[model samples]
Target: MNVETETMKNEAAPEIRIGGGVPVLGPRDTPVAEVVHACHSASIDQGLAALAIPGLNRETLEPVLQYCAGLRCVADNVSCPGCKRRTEAQGIETLDQFILSKKEVIVGDGRVRLKGEGTETVTTPCLETLSKQWSGENYWFWARRVIRKLRHGLRRAHMRGEPVAGEGETPSIILMEPQLADNIGMVARACANFGLDDLRLVSPRDGWPNEKARIAASGANYIIDDARAYGTLEESIADLNWVGATTARQRDLRKPVLTPEQAIVEMRKRISRGERCGVLFGRERNGLETSEVAVADAFIMIPVNSRFASLNLAQAVLLTGYEWMRSDAGRSLGRVTTYEKPLTEGLYLGRDRPATKEELLGLFEHLERELETNGFFNPAHRRSTVSQNLRTLLTRLNATEQEVRTLRGIVATLSQGKGRARKREE
Candidate 1:
């Protein structure tokens, strides 16, 4: 059963409220109803009644725990629907009904009806509802402690609960002779971060299922739990058809030294040829030996500074994996946000076509009239050159028909001042 349900079994009244905001220790046999009445009469927070119990044991007063423990399908402040129904059936009301009793309450999105009284339907309990009810500092302090203790459990409800592996032609990440379990865990985390799940460890130093490694991995338990340990690098990548060793050094070996992008493209080409591929990342302290690099088909080099060309085990894995995903044609590059119709047509802008030669000439004539009237052309001989230059500039802009019309409208507005004045004088 839950903590709240376990605490309800203990039959005891909370502290009795004396006059002047003082609390008198009630007997162990005091009823919950009397305790609630005293809290209401003394203007005390009803949830604070649990504080009256000596030593403040949560196990004994779990029913009155207002803030949510943040477990799966559970929340704070708002009463559980199951608990509410049970208590309502027992003829008990008001207690544990702090948020639900309100006729209407405001949440994050908008307003919500607490009861089935209005046209709007009663909304489900969410973060907004929980945050609204328990506004006490003391309550929040306890709530934070509870949340920290059960932080991992909070995501249990939303988790898919499946090992992420073998979606398509994903390259496996093989770590050769890793020293630290924390590094292994971090590598696993990086693999998970980039959707590369196949983690093969070649004889980790601290052994498999290391607690420190799991702790370092945080919530990436899937990669850690499914991590396979092999005796050697050869055994680790034996199932793979091709292998790429990631190193920062420039060696004298005859093997092709390819950048991360080139390595990923080669791996993809090999994958398309119905061959499995894996990238070998050496230990954290010293990277793969020259002999070990010889086994790989290519050397995957990250273009870093030549002076300090070293990367952490997880960093190398992450970079290579990112490049692999980048080169993979299956994955979408970014969020797709294309409209069904053409932008100009959907926006209802008149003249979706480009400006024709006739329309362009008409706009040029209209603008030339204004420029001539305003004495923009200082000399008549330079007028043709100036007009040709203007036409060339306008042509370079590739302004649409709508844009040409807009320029014409602007020219008409600026040049109509004298005509308006003459008409007024007439």
Candidate 2:
């Protein structure tokens, strides 16, 4: 009779706790099932090897590979020498072996084994459910997504693209209790300016998912659109093992609060070691509350004057982002040196011919009329002075043609007042 016992030791899964490497399955002769699980969960190289072979069903797949690594292999499809002749042979018939390449296969004959390399990779009909259909446009998109997923040894998405040294993985950012739309827009801009695209917002104040935020976001609309809104902070960061909070004031909890530099060091340490981490930025007015701070594994402080330590929500984001880039991680995450010259070859063909005299006069007339409407000209003040002041502000920015037009519209609206423009007496 086959040896059997209830509750056989399975040191394979994390469930088993044994000192000094004693096999969890008792004797070295423990069952194959327990042996397999132990080896698969151990590391990157071995786990994939197990997936490449057959025999263990998907259920037992993880466990058997976890333990059975470096164990003896079958010579033929049938029989192990340990199982003697004249006795029924227990062979693994479930091995649905596949070729790593078009040319080679790992095969075992009774008492003999051989290895051969495949010249070309075999095309097994795409087996996974989620694999996308191939298309020309997708070729580029998937390549970029794949690049985004890479963990190390490559130029990061934050930098200009490079030959694949490796891939960089973008981390997620979590915000708690946002009170203002401008702050949200600024945060969105910060995320886009850096490499972080995953934004999670919890319990927003006033109105969010509104037009005002979209307007403020400007070029960062995609980031704002992709942002995830949650009901609470804990739920927001639940998946992250390492959490950091930002604060400007003192609190009762003794949790370590680090300066932006120090926090980046700590967060960098964990990230390099493959820990999932998230940084929390609190509301605009009060910053993160004590309740929210309690759950954080660490705190990040922006060093500001004690008497005047307050910072706008977006300004804090800028500092944190700048620090994040200096972390050891920032180095490997694909930092590149921008050259003195532009990366592209040339500027637009018509970059600057300057508008004709007629165009310039027309622009000034439109602008003056717009300024006159928006209270840019006080009823009691010198109209020419007010108009000049308004002109100076726009001039300082060196407004582009398109931007000039948009500003004119806003001014025009102010001048015409909020009432609907009259429809032609229809």
Candidate 3:
């Protein structure tokens, strides 16, 4: 669930090449879509080169239409890499669909990524209420930035139900297909109160970047890391040795919907036996869908009025989590920090600058050749100050990883005898 932060990214256009090999366009002329399309094609180099040339207009892209008119045969053989093992059987028909959808196109290498048209908006009861609470729910819109941060944090590191250790118990909280951002945040708060750090949201309906969720989470934001969002109900409950389903209406499920007390007793028994198990909760409204109850090992229900039974999202999570805690499994398992890249030494005056070894050597070598070629360096008497000053100037700029690579190449070119001869000829 990576959120798209910036709108209208300016990408370099694609490059054109003949069918077999050969580049035809300069970098500026490369078509952006062609480069993106090549990501799906067979060969990257050839694909990139092909992208440089403009494809026929959408109306003119049909090979069959072109062939029928005796212009050119359209190639329908290319397949989409996203769904592999399946060739693009739709041909021109599929192309029309893509045009209609206006999918994102980025070309390079032999792989093309399609951030398909926006996700479908489900018209659930939750949507209407969520819209009222946190405004609209567009993942890419500028108004929804906090939501993007949450999405970024989740994607940068994989989240899981943290393992339990020591003689303490672990807390459990379930979020059934939370569709709105605010609901997820409120659920996080409920977990915080009952000492439940782990959360499971099944098949998130709204996707991610839910600002309402972050605003609602308040202080208990870290559980967002422990919150594991799944694609299906079974997947959400798979790891739990004991499962409890939250529902209001009576069902044919053999398992009973015990009050919070009865459910806690069973959960405690399971935990005492040193087993992993949890009590589940359904979405705020519409409760648990029929399919969700099918896989439950047991059922847990919150009794409400027969006519009006809607409860706040946080209230439900708290109810279930509070029940789980009663069984002696609702203690903090201690905080574990997951680090992304480890720390490293930077370029220093005494220890030497970053890329302290090879990059420095390359930089010096490059500088000497450039000076010599431009007649800037007096060969008869080399002045150390000149070279040192040059280094100081470049180091201050803090050249980027790519800039350094390019500079090194320039130096290597100027240092070669053939290069010098060619320079003289030019």
Candidate 4:
């Protein structure tokens, strides 16, 4: 089996040389979706050029190539053959591992250079930019999700009648330079889970209209479809009446630090007065920068352990969204479907009423008669005390009418005989 697989991998390379030497990524007659899938799968197992997909050209493959390259390098860092070979040889899968394996060269302008083997050098973005972009994402997993989207349409695409928030009803969730499309999708899901409708992205890392984001959204396709991406943070929040930037690190800025609950309250007040409100979340790698935070009217801080205050992008959005919907009058404890009614806090007694006092008395009398017949109260002197104790225990049950009937039936069956026992006695 191993030999056959190796032969197939070797044979797959030559099939790319067809139709005037244009590289095809899959076999002839392959569906476009299958070709895309093969391209991504081959990009992981082999290189991007491994597959020979028919009808796949540079123009058609540009998006996949860009996505693959973005996943391999950090923040527009150039991919080098030497670095690729070294990473493949050493089985280095993570960005941190790739960074550590190479020698860092600090240039005169404070820019970092990654020196790979044999004169191959790659220039990287600033440390802060690198930190913001490199999220330790699984490239292959992302590829599979993209492939899934190509094969099947967005999740819950057929479902309809999702509640839409009205104007000023909820705050717009603004994500500033989120690195992972998956994180953005999860943030959309979080937004949908609450009542927040508007989603704005400022300089998303992988670019907008990403299938990965749609796939990551699970069933919240509406949010993903409606999400707007902007080139700058200013452009993203220009229409908002007020904006709060969420962060864990304390900034020296004099802006008010409001908790998530307090921020939601302020937003609700502003929105009630016909003002648009928004919440700004920073990148997944590092939270918002000081300059970015300065743009917001206030700082929204969630209470957490001081030592470990950093949260995932979706988590921060989810927490803020929860607070926004916490006091909603129309909100149910959980989902309310056609068959399932909304529930409140208390014991649920479905289709059953509490036992009446007369029913309780009848049960007590029946149980006492059974006990007396079975000689359960052995000592005649203490019969009254034992009977009182039994009555107290039975009264405390607070059983329903159905429960009382079940108890009586149990007592009768045990005192007499049931099924096989009755047959044996006969």
> What lDDT score belongs to each candidate, Candidate 1 first?
0.63, 0.53, 0.53, 0.71
Cα deviation at 369, candidate 1, in Å, is: 4.5
Residue 328 deviation, candidate 2, in Å? 6.1
Best candidate, TM-score: 4
What are the models' TM-scores?
Answer: 0.49, 0.39, 0.40, 0.68
Clashing residue pairs for model 4:
24-52, 24-53, 25-52, 25-53, 26-52, 26-53
Off by over 4 Å in 3: 1-168, 208-212, 326-426
The sequence of per-residue lDDT tens digits that candidate 4 reaches over residues 297-401 is 999999999989999999999999898888676777778799998877676778899999999999989888889888888887888998899889988988899
Model 3 / residue 61 / CA error / Å = 41
Q: Which wins on TM-score, candidate 1 or candidate 4?
A: 4
Superposed model 2: Cα runs more than 4 Å off:
1-171, 328-426
lDDT by residue (1-426, candidate 1, tens digit) is: 987745654545343333322222344543333333333222232334543554233343333322222321122112232233223433444423544444554444565434522232334456543554332222323443333323333222243234444543778888888988778868877887677878888888767756556655656777777788898888987889888888887778888888989988887788788889988999887898998998998888898978888998888888887886666545554332563332321334444778899999999998898899999998888999999999999888777898998887777767776577345335
Candidates 1 and 2 compared: the better one by lDDT is 1
Question: Which lDDT value does model 3 have at 381?
Answer: 66
Q: Which candidate number would show the highest lDDT if scored against the true structure?
A: 4
Q: How many residue pairs clash in all the candidates, one count each?
A: 1, 28, 21, 6
